[model samples]
Target: MSASPHPLHELDPAPAPSVLALVPAPAPVPAVPVVPANRAPRANTPLMRKEHRDNIALFRYQVIRGAADPSLSTRQRGPLVRALALVDHPWPYGGTRRFSRESLDRWIKAWHRDGFDGLKPDERATAPGTDPSILLLAESLKREKPNRTTAQVKRIITETLGQAPSETTLLRHFRAKNISTGARPVATGRFETVASNEIWVGDALHGPRIGGRKTYLFAFLDDHSRMVTTARWAWAEDAIRLSAVLRPALETHGIPEVLYLDNGAAMSDKSLARTCAKLGIKLVHSAPYRPQGRGKIERFFNTVTSQFLGEITVTDTPMLPGTAPEAGSQIGSLEELNTLFTAWVNMVYHHQQHSSTGQTPLTRWEASWEHRTPVRKPLETIRQAFLWSDTRKVSKTGTVSLHSNSYEVDPLLAGTSIELVYDPFDLDGEITVNNNQGIPAGTAKPVDIGRHVHTKVINAVKDNDTATNINTGINYLDLVATRHRQSLSGAPISFADLHDHTTPKNQTQPAVSEEEQP
Candidate 1:
């Protein structure tokens, strides 16, 4: 009945199948080849065509460039698409040509990131000795010679900083800093004068004509000292051009707290207003047609006219034979005139004691600046002074036409209305353009197709010189003889009388010639 004692005792339960030990079976793992660490991953193997990578890179590049340009409308994106297609035409298939779109994309991406630097083929590396201090030195030199050439700028830097960079290096520095030459602005805001140099009065004077030509005199005088700080000749009195002359006064004598000027066409330049704002100088405009507010300078010029220009002429010639009347002279030439004027200013004008200051203008100016604080302005802030305003429409080529001249803009601004703020003083046609929102789009140099506001040769040369020489071919004898013939008065006058009638146009009006006198 017990069935042989459950048989468990007889077999010993087969030792419980050795529960403490495990039997190992052979693995079914596939064979794997060992790869060296220097080898690339399988996914990056050259089994794929190199051209394929290049094509993809080219496609990506075009897309990215297209998206970044807001000026390129969808309708106008044909060129971009076509360019991409051409660039990606030969996909990498591991043929004789092995090119990758990725490489093209890499270069393009770099260019977008770095401007000219992005295009550097790696041959033109950055300067080795460049430092932040070099930037400061470059900036200082830029302020002094804003219109300097790259070489000139480098020379100045080397002279002043004792370390000159190459022209290319200097240009790179300037481009990085956005250093540009522009005209300074006129004064703006309310005009107030508490002390001398606190307010300077500027005006234009019509000086006596020498050699039958007119000349312009621009002057800036301290309101209190009545001292003429600066004066120079110009054909026309434009506001922006005048500002250039006043710049030295501002830099050397210190900026006046305010300026008083007439409402001449030249004084109404928007750049002048912007300049005053940037420099924190207030501009006061004289009441229209009322010359009293600006009378100080007006009177000073009158005194100059009466005491100097009128009494003496740079070209001394007897007024009339045996009359002994005071002779008049010409300033000789523009250069000679400038030298004389400088001498007169330094030796006679500035050194002379002012009635108001009881000290020389220089002395008074020095004293005034002693207690005065110099206005410090960043180069950008000062650049704002040179900005002038003109409303213009973008042309088909994104150019704006002004004063019979055309200026270019970024392609994105095409068909847009823009306000051009330009420096009239910059002979190079530099300008700052802005949108209606007052955001500066950027600075540009326009193609100058118009006459300059100020030129050294003077208008007389332009008018009188049929060629390069400064003569109009009018003879005194021809004029006097013609006049004498007309006034014969039935008297039996001989050819000798005609000879006696010979006199210059200065002495009397010439006889009416068949041709008109210009």
Candidate 2:
């Protein structure tokens, strides 16, 4: 009764069904492939960079993919687009920064096409070694005279290429690539003087071709300051050119105590030595086979080669004369080249820290400010000293002959030996006549000549025409007299024939030649 104890557990509720037993076994878990340990881990190498770049590139891919999806509305796209520029991402080598969405798009394409390898930076296709002129010169130098001394090879390369690699860069390349001609190393032991203007070393460096002609740079380097005194590109490496560069340098940088140079013919000329002596500069020459003495200037020239000329020489842009050049190429003439070099020297080189002196050349040169002692010679005297000179005796008529032209000298200079100082191009501008004691006698003027010495060769044609006019009054009077006489003598006077057919009756006209008559 009492429901039999409410079924007293009703024989226990039937056991609940096992949910785990009823559920189907999960699909076998996918095995995560383990990377092997022995494979060299790319640490700080380009390869390691490639992996990080790949992940970043994948992210970019996903971003772009979401952008193309119609499901991503403007609300979603706006922030995503803004985040590309604002959000910082790890860059491979240059450092971490935000990239342009466009750049991200490019990387994504790179990775999609080439996989991880595409993410690596591409090697530069244009290196100094790959330059056609440099390579040809290097190979030619090695082949022509195998086993040339390194120094000899260096000189050859410098002369041929108009610039040569630094000794260290060249030698490293030579050893690594077997391009060295077996040769002895350079001998060391050099003399160095202190103070910026105390000593200056001068040397010549071949320069890149301008148009069809090659150039040679005559330069002087301040030993103490490492400052380039003056540099000019010349077609000839002679005393004239050297003096041309030296005079300006002396004027600007002050006279050096000693001028050191190699045994080049131009450097050893008596004219340079005389000039140096006159300026109180002790001219010193390095012993044969001793370039170490001029190491400063040589290194300076090397810097010009590597820093200035190298950048210009690597250009592949063709520069045919008369043809317009591509942008960034100012290499049209020697003047332009020097203009560029001057700007570079005054603005860039003078301001930069030198590797050896740890000071800018201008700063170093200016540092010992009180040490400067410029020459006191009059500018005219300095000018005369630098210019080309010759002696000629004035004729009795106060005239002198030079370069096959007659010049009128001072009346007092007549029948006396005098020195002629003048520029070769300025014959008409006249020249200064100095006595044997170097005192100015007077100025000489070139005699007038109707003919020009040299006519310009131009591509255009010009007209050289002449005409003559004579008064017709006398002829007209004679005609009138004849006509009156003919009337008085009863001869016919045809008034119709008295005037020109092309002119009015009262108008005066020129008499026509017999050949002009119809």
Candidate 3:
């Protein structure tokens, strides 16, 4: 074959001018100037005044300064933020100065990003038609019904105006105007009962460590007399410990008409509620997070921390009333701590004149009984009031299980739910079974004992006895094996001989054939 005039690669012809002219070129991209990573954007923009920017930045810095410390560990930051959150600060724009932990965290992050300028408030452009009139209407709607939420107000505005600003915008405006959906301020004044034993304010204080385990002081104060009705230190802060403190108070001081307590798990336990109900004492729990009415008990705790706990020292012999502890004395055990506290409370605190009451707690408590008698309940009735109960459905086998311990109930109670009322600390003791209607059904007898007490009770006991004595060296399984060997010691090995050996002494032995003999 002849070679082509052009090589195979150069054989194609050029395109027409019309085709070349039809193709368009790509558009050019705008150049964005590179800003250094370390450089922060200017916060004092032309629109904002210098004074405004400074004020905003200062407020942010003050709110987050403590939490933003570089040396603070992760664990320390949380407590710092929480403490700051509790405080009220001066706002630059003039309003409620409280900042939430989340807000503080965000401010800290902003400070890290831009040093000082990042802390300045972001100036967001207001959406169109968000005029003062619409805000006024929203405010009116909120004021019309204090219960109406921000979102509900927004919905009402949206329906009326065909378009409404965002909920955040409405909230900001509402907040600035001092209109809030939260609890309204109520007129409050100091209150006291006309006589003692009218109301008892109860609370618990977290006490110092005794023998390496934390202790809690459960106390009740007479609201009228400011007397410490009952107080005791316990290893646990559960309903059982609370009962131990309260039962004695009721017995010694007589029952109060009302029991005022905070909404703690130990305070709000159903057992306590049941106890109060049975005793006809009104149980009232303070609103959650509101401690306005609990100042007396709190003051009592402060006195305890300062006056009593400061002087305690572990000693083989009890310290005299006015004597200070020797420097070398050890930290006391729980029993010693309680002993010292009881002595201090009786001799010192009860006799000291209270600033608010103007009389010693003991004197006030006694004086209140001059004209009126305190309501008293029988010891047996009070004991029955404090017992804890659990509801269980009896199984088909006429048994009920409590804390994994099985107990046999009345056969009639089978296939029915019944209440198991017993001492939480003594689960192995008598458990009174009551029917669904709360009538006495029968007693619950132990069938299979797995646990002798509730799990919490076991923990409390361990907390109380921090230094458990060494176990006595005894192997139960080995003892059982030895008993088995002793039982088999003189018995014949052959099955027939074993049966004959076990026969009564007066009964004639079975005659064995020679073939069958071993």
Candidate 4:
């Protein structure tokens, strides 16, 4: 097999000198006629050797002067002699870069060790040199700052040892320990604590589109506490997007030992994973579609849909006041609904006792959170949750068809598709609808047939042919009552009452059609 690619330089070497062939001996030429005011010099006067001699003379003069000076030292003069070797140019050192002493020392060391191979970069070590101590330092740096580059590590090495190790050396050291320079696997699938606040699960939930629009909800719930840490609305579920919601959860309540979530695009981002690694908090993701593993967060989403989004009415407006339109409102277009939800979460939900825990999530958190501590997810980890997906058109009536039900989107989405992405289990989970230019269409409203009202009841009555479609069971209540209770108060009312009320007080002879008369 072919040899592996060389690692980055441990020592940068200088360019080798060019070897030139010897010239044959030549007869000395007589001096050429000098050019005079009255006569032109010889037609083909050869001046190349003369110019070369002149340059050599000038360089020698400068070197002698430089060496003779009291301030100049041998260490500085040696490089000047080397510079004098190229004397044809006005400046002998022109256009050439020189290696520092340390750099040259490294180059010489590599050359002696590997011969011609030294001319090429060294093969990277599988581990950081033979020095276990330096490897330990590198490991610590990696743990402390996973995103740090080789150059950064080198700087750190310099700080500790007063010298930088070759990048290749560091790479080899990491490789020996099976540490990859890029994309080290994130630790996942490890078991976590069962108690709330012991591990907090966070996720995104997709909600129905309103007025032909969609939206997303982000939520965090404690594992032991079972209390909702926080919930927010967003158009995307990017890592950065989710971190904004997660930060308050971590800061307000101490840190959670473990943060659990699904292997969504946002959570899988390398930047986020690296952040978690540095924080020493284990980041766990549920196996694809095995949501049962994260039942708590799943239950949270179910409640969010049935109780929160179901009750709200989204209205499109500037996402941030003063800016052009952003996301549509959730909870309700009414600020009152938003305030109510916020209040309920902080005051009621956090304090409410869980059926499983038999204590409020906040109380449990207060007991154990200070010491175990929750991790502060970095901002980079929060940025991965965002992705772009295409939007769809809404009909003139402001309804967009999704799955089976028609949801209300913003008026602006009329006959246009937009882009969107979100977590399906977050507090504000839903495909947030956006306008043509990607602004929130407005909060999505679910299209529903409300409780049976007067009109529906009247319509049902009109559709029924009472007399012809009457069931004989209509009289069963009268028979049951006679067989059971004797009191009028407890007796069952039946069709018998209809007949008794309709009967005339006095009997009268009635003529009817032959078919009707019996």
For model 1, residues 1-518, the per-residue Cα lDDT tens digits are 33232111121222333222222332343322323445523322333334334343443433345422434333233333334435433222221223243444454457457643453344323355777677677676566435444554454455345677676777766766668744233223233255666778888887655455566777788776666756666445665336545554553455678888888876766667777887889988888866666656755664455334532343423346666432322344444334344334444455556554478766765666567665645444444564556777787887777766767787788888887875443424566788766788985556756754334222322432121222222221122233344432212211112112222121121111111101
* Candidate 2 per-residue C-alpha lDDT over 1-518 given as tens digits, one digit per residue, 9 for 90 to 100: 23231110121132234422332443453322223445434434456555644544444444344333334333333344445657775433333467775565455456557764565555434355545566555555555445444444454465434677665655555564556446433322256556777888888888886555567888887787777777766555766556656664554456778888999999997667767766777989989985667777776666566445633421224547897432122354554445445545554466668767789988877776675554455444554455445799989999988767788988887888998876433445557889878898888887953322212101001111111222222221122233333222111112111111232122111110011000
- Which of the two, 2 or 3, has more TM-score? 3
TM-score per model over all chains = 0.45, 0.45, 0.50, 0.32
Any residue pairs clashing in model 2, and if so which? 7-10
Which regions of candidate 3 deviate over 4 angstroms? 1-189, 313-330, 462-518
Q: Which scores higher on TM-score, 2 or 4? A: 2
- Best model per lDDT: 3
State the displacement of the C-alpha of residue 174, model 1, in Å, after optimal TM-score superposition. 66
Candidate 4 lDDT, 341-382, residue by residue in tens: 444455435555665667776786677556655544443333
- What TM-score would you give candidate 1 relative to the actual structure? 0.45
Q: What lDDT is reached at residue 31 by model 1?
A: 23
User: Each prediction's Cα RMSD?
Assistant: 33.3, 27.2, 33.0, 31.4
Per-residue error for 357 in candidate 2, Å, reads 3.8
Residue 65 miss distance in model 3 (angstroms): 58
Residue range with the least summed lDDT across 10 consecutive positions in model 2: 509-518
Residue-pair clashes per candidate, as listed? Answer: 21, 1, 0, 70
